[model samples]
Target: MTATATAAVIAPAPEAAPALRDTRPLRLITCGSVDDGKSTLIGRLLWDTKAVKEDQAAALNRDSGKQNDLGLPDFALLLDGLQAEREQGITIDVAYRYFATDKRSFIVADTPGHEQYTRNMATGASTADLAVLLVDARAGILEQTRRHATIATLMGIKQFVLAINKIDLINYDKARFDELSLEFKEIALSLGVKQVTAIPVSALKGENVVYDGKASMPWYEGPTLVEVLELATVRSAQTVGFRLPVQRVSRPGESFRGYQGTVAGGAVKPGDSVVILPSGMVANVKQIVTFDLVRNAAVAGDAITLVLDRQVDVARGDMIATIDAQPQVGLAFDAQLVALQPGGIEPGKRYWLKSGSRRQRVSVQPSSLLDLKSGKWNRHDGALPMNAIGKVHLSFDEAAIFDAYELNRTTGAFILIDPDTNNTVAGGMISAKRGDLGGLNNEAERVILSLPADLADKILASGILSERRDEIDIRRTNPGRAAELLGELDS
Candidate 1:
């Protein structure tokens, strides 16, 4: 990442993106293990791109704790802005920086590398379009590197840049670079991430980061880190449905009423029929109001006040989505989450589940834990320890609304807040909707028949009982328990 200064130049649009979007900047995050040079990598990029102002650069030089032997001031000072971080010589929080090249703009999050602050790393990764995972060349790949990469993949980031930092310390070895790149690529492939680009960088010396490192290594012919980011895919079109989690109902005057929120997924236009979630009241979109103009259409990420055809008792925390592609509404759902804080996730404890703007109480039961070392989801005891990634069952007292994370990121993601401490304990993604205990009208008339989930699914998908689907509640159970239930109910 460090080298002689050069003029910023425009880069051509990347081949991976559907179209190079100029409206929004490419958002990315830099992360890895402690002292992996995440901050230095970002700082070097910012400095090279001229994102650091003159006075700020002067201040950076003045306050740099220790200058490197290469004659450049410590670049890490640019991003490690906090006093605690400065004193400890480690990043404890996430710092975001915005910079631009002639070809594109970027929003980079410099996240903490320590295990205790993995929650902060998750928070930064939540909105990132790509992940630049820095690994010390001398250290190769560490457990924390794999952990961050796993978290980024789970957050839906497909593009990854394995920044093998401090390659200078390794004497710019080509064999070592290839070995590390292959190792990371294999790990990435196992996690279903195929868009992997490995770059050798020296953050303090500014090697193959913004400037080419051909002088040091003529054998390397790959593009610089900036070139890869300029072409990486930006727009995500994986969602088939529209989602607007209503943040508030805007009404400046009694004559006009509109629901205001940022579009979470898909696109909406006037006359589109949308169903209010939980209540399931259908209405047509009448107008889209924005500060700049009354738009005819709005897509995901647009902030607008949407007026409905008629008043249907819309309120905060309600979701407005396309009726034809409605999300799953049920009493229970399955989720995979990262246990964040030291307290971890306690089984059967009621916590506040905040998905979008809606927050409600739900009980969580851990089912399995992901073993990062082995890349497997193993059966875990009901409790999850800190930094543990586990799959869980979420039981709600009322109807729960979600789309599987694979379908819609906004509607499918959530965070669990501990009521006692009022702190976020875990960040999760909805996997699927499953049956729950007895949403039937009368418990006395209810038949508690258990069946294999696949069998129940087959019966429901057959359409023979489509009209009366709600009348017959399906609870999935193991094969042995299902057979036992069938025997007990025999005539």
Candidate 2:
């Protein structure tokens, strides 16, 4: 009997799906180990879905020297566009491809799987709503698979589709597929991933991609790759208030002054009360301007110009947000970042942190590095090495404004730019404000606990602590500090 292990994954039957669906294009990424067939899987999707044209198909047939076991031309050639990549038979960079079905449209990023190219994977995963992680059936899972999954999860990709590719190589064995699914579920659970779906596929032969593979494996009954993507939702539902990070101030004439930028979160309308961050100036939306016409209302992802009713000292790098539901304004914040450059992140070094459209000088201090093998964040001091994922404390020269990445990815994610070279060195996600206790007064008391990260995570996850989670603040600390705190409590 096939185990109901993937039930937690929200994959409904096609006939049972909702008629009214979200029309937004679903952004996803295909990632796993090298030779796991990431590019081939995408090419197969394009070929089967009719996204490939006649001329391109002819070129694929003409240039392709190697063919798979099914007597099919190398589908991976479609994505590996560079001449060198074709000769090397390797993916060198992240390739963004667009394809649409009658039901929905998609934007998929096919990321490189090499460990050295992990930074490229981070770039692709940052904006992706879902991750289609591929795995070789014979190989099960590799370290690179864990690396990609960890980075994707950290970058807030909640939905995952584990494509067990090359199932025909293992004789389409149902037992092997089941075993990989179970193993993946365990790893996903450990990484705090709740939504996951596993499918057995053979990209070389195009089984279980866009069409059903009932003839190949009659025992499995599930949706295909296209079906899952059509229904996959973006990760911006849990949003609060309105956010407009001013990219530029437009003043065509002396009479006209408009703040131009994309709406990062929530919605804005005329006469809506908005506050400018870093300066704390209040204003009201007088007119919403666009290139074509004035918009009555603008929601997240909309790019529009805004005219405030009153004169405010607004400039580039300033944030315009709702008054009541404003983002955190502070000088210190905790964040997790992946070092992208070879020089790594040097502690106590000032770098330009760019979030949304705002860029400001900030100093970073590395505190802990995540060990992918152990699945633990170990205490560390000093510079973060290249491609290393580490937790750091950011100190800005002036007030910095941001929401927690979990709450608003647009306002919460940022990149660190090296001051001397002007090159981006790291990508980061803001975890929380340094010393924020929301809506708490002096009369109201709160409990603060310093515990080992593992124990603290367990307690925070427990139902008992979860009910009053707001009343308590638990901070994970190094073992020495945790022990010292325990001793002080006993004394």
Candidate 3:
């Protein structure tokens, strides 16, 4: 008997999976040599992301009387918002744009690419987590490319995207792309940057920018520019212990007193014990207060008003940190800086150093300058010229607080303002604490304070040693050693 064919059933197609999206915004900067199409690339990104409103697009069309052969309006017009920039067809300042996609959102800074505007580029790169370094395929790598990469690396940017723009000019040749990518990879490696993604694209034609260019070049199978950003990690200050630099002491009424500042480094809870720097005053965190709510905890990047269990002498320029993990307090520090202005950073010059919310007078002594082209530090004892990356020693007139830049950037980085001009001259990162004999010698003056451990703790808690904290060194010694040291001092 032939059994009737079993009724066939087909499973309904699974509903299309919802596209995964990253809501957190990625902050990035676009920088390169002059005429590398930085504005065009950013404009292309904004247009492709549909961030441009209809009215803005209409204005772009109106402003740009002529369109390219592809019928796309002058994309640079979208970014060069200044009339001077439009007239000169160049970006003079840092232009910021915000856009989003199904995968992620982005906040991009279109920075000026001129050599003289390196300061502007550095300003943009300061807050960027990733840098999209552009280069014209026809021009290959330029000196400004290296300069920008060096600046970005120095600013703690780890992820880099080398966009080989104007690929259409070279016929989108894979060989050309490979050569440039290999060269740039070596440069990135030299800068201690390992996360580098190189892509071939023509910003003018919108290839491999926000969209895939499979039709133009089928060989490229990797993700587009937007894809790299979606997966990149956001730079977080939570890697270290908590540090809050007091911007101001907020006292609205007799009933309330709060320390207002952004958490520079780790996290703090309501019951955590903290120390006020430069004063060594200890207090327990009573509340984490914000405008909208009284929070239980606060982490890095949180701007909150903190109330302590009792009123201690907390003031602006003072740092409140976890008691067990205090920042380095010293009178001298070694730093790496990029000289910004034409006057250059002169040796033995006193400049105002602003780090976090603290500003202090610092004597800068130039030690060495970095040669961007050769990637070598040249022995230089003279002035650090404009656009020069140099190593210097910073001697503070008073107690200074900082962390190693590698450990916590927010507390370690600073900007130098020229006292004469009152203009910013350099941006620097603290490398390490300098000893008595520069950074070479570890020997330092030791002030042996012979007191009971309990008494010493009380003195520290009393905040009497805060002003002289950096000058005084406390050593935990056995009774025998303490007696010996006391006898030696008496002798």
Candidate 4:
């Protein structure tokens, strides 16, 4: 299937995740440095939750036979199923696991735990509702730990659970656990993480992972890993705004095709008035549809097709949402971009901006570079280098509606892809607009008079009537006089 076709079938969850108590399953992304037992911890969680199948459990029991240690289950094998992964005993690819308890269903993306593979971890964690960060108790807080925390924060993961694994190696000592917990707590808090719960676990022995065997440290007063995950409440966890980027316009068998997507937030009901973004085309939501189910109102996380009251020339890359909460439209907005590789982002290089299922052509104009180590935004360094996060002013080929990452992630978060290679070069979040920094007069007169007539029409239609009228007058007047008039208007 085409990229657009695949994106249409697979719904992308928007910014705010649903509540912990909601009907939707909790989706989490697990990230850690190498050998931190991210897979083992997750495997044990599944095992204890009774989500593991009998065949898988039997296979794990058989393959884990060591030369001296026999009959022990290789829990890691449950997730690291690839032959290369078993030979090396290190995760090299992302493995997705689905399991659920009586309380919540989960979709866990188990990412590689290597420093060099940090970019992959970022990709998985970007859409996570909560981040399960594993730290080796023996290693304490390493550089990679800080790196993962930084990426998690940058990716907008608000709730964090710091699972300090391999505690058995430290003899399950309270002093060691307390010391490490305090240190990691300070780091997590500094990263602006909303929640941090430190749990000591021997993923190898299943201590504190599932039931916290009596042989493990009894002095520990904290809940088991399973309890914390099942009981922890994340209030205001995610914004539930309505964001459905039209991934595809499909007409099956007859002329009955419709727009399809996974609802990111809010509810969509039949007869709800909606507007398609960028185009501003309005249509009534004719039906809340899915291949298997049709309903009056569909809430957050429902992957379904939408039948509009009228065929309003909708297409892929367009977004349809209720008229009440319209997305903010603009071509220029500030975004925080994090580079994954060594190459820097060239100021004038064109890239594809991927938000939800929508993609737009955009140019990266340098603004300020953020130094991750020092925690400061600096003047232009020509371009953003690898493993670096910076803020840039993006100029899109067309205006797109978006929300501030702080307000709604579905609309605020976006990915920058190389137009030539189609490789995702940068991950970004909309912070604010540069124009929002100054007075309204300066923003009004900042446009060029020579823009195409269609663009001029859009600027006029954007409801900034004064700017439109001023632009029209400038175009009709002499160039030198127009400059002077604009200067006066700004002043």
* Candidate 4 residue-wise lDDT, 267-380, digit = tens: 778877677776766677788778788888886677889998887988887887656565566667878877776575878888888888887888888778755455556898
lDDT of 1 by residue, 190-276 (tens): 999999999998888888889999999788899999999988878484376788889999889999998999998899999887888
For all candidates in order, the CA lDDT equals: 0.86, 0.87, 0.87, 0.74
Return the candidate ranking by lDDT, descending. Answer: 3, 2, 1, 4
lDDT for model 2, please. Answer: 0.87
Each model's RMSD to truth, in Å?
9.8, 12.2, 6.7, 11.9
Q: Compared to the true structure, candidate 1 yields what TM-score?
A: 0.85
Clashes of 1: 7
Please tell me which model should have the higher TM-score, number 3 or number 4: 3
Q: List model 3 lDDT by residue over 20-128, tens digit each.
A: 6666789999999999988999999999889999999999889877657777799999999888898899999999999998777889999999988899999999889
lDDT by residue (tens digit), candidate 2, 1-491 = 13564653445655455455557889999999999999999999989888999999999999875565557989898899987788888888889998888778899999988887888899999889999999999998998898889889889989999999999888899999999999988899999998999999988788999988999999889988898998898777438889999999999999999999999999999988787887767778999999999989999989999999998999998999886577887778889999999999999999999987778899999999988777788999799999898999998888899998888888999999999999999999998777543232221434556466676666556565676778776654457766776566446
Candidate 3 runs further than 4 Å off:
1-19, 440-491
Please report, as a residue range, the 10-residue window in candidate 3 with the lowest summed lDDT: 8-17
Clash counts for all predictions: 7, 0, 0, 6
Q: Find the candidate with the highest TM-score and give its number.
A: 3
Best model number under lDDT: 3
TM match of model 4 to true structure: 0.77
- What's model 2's lDDT at 230? 87
Candidate 4 runs further than 4 Å off: 1-23, 67-71, 213-215, 233-241, 250-260, 286-294, 303-313, 342-344, 366-380, 436-491
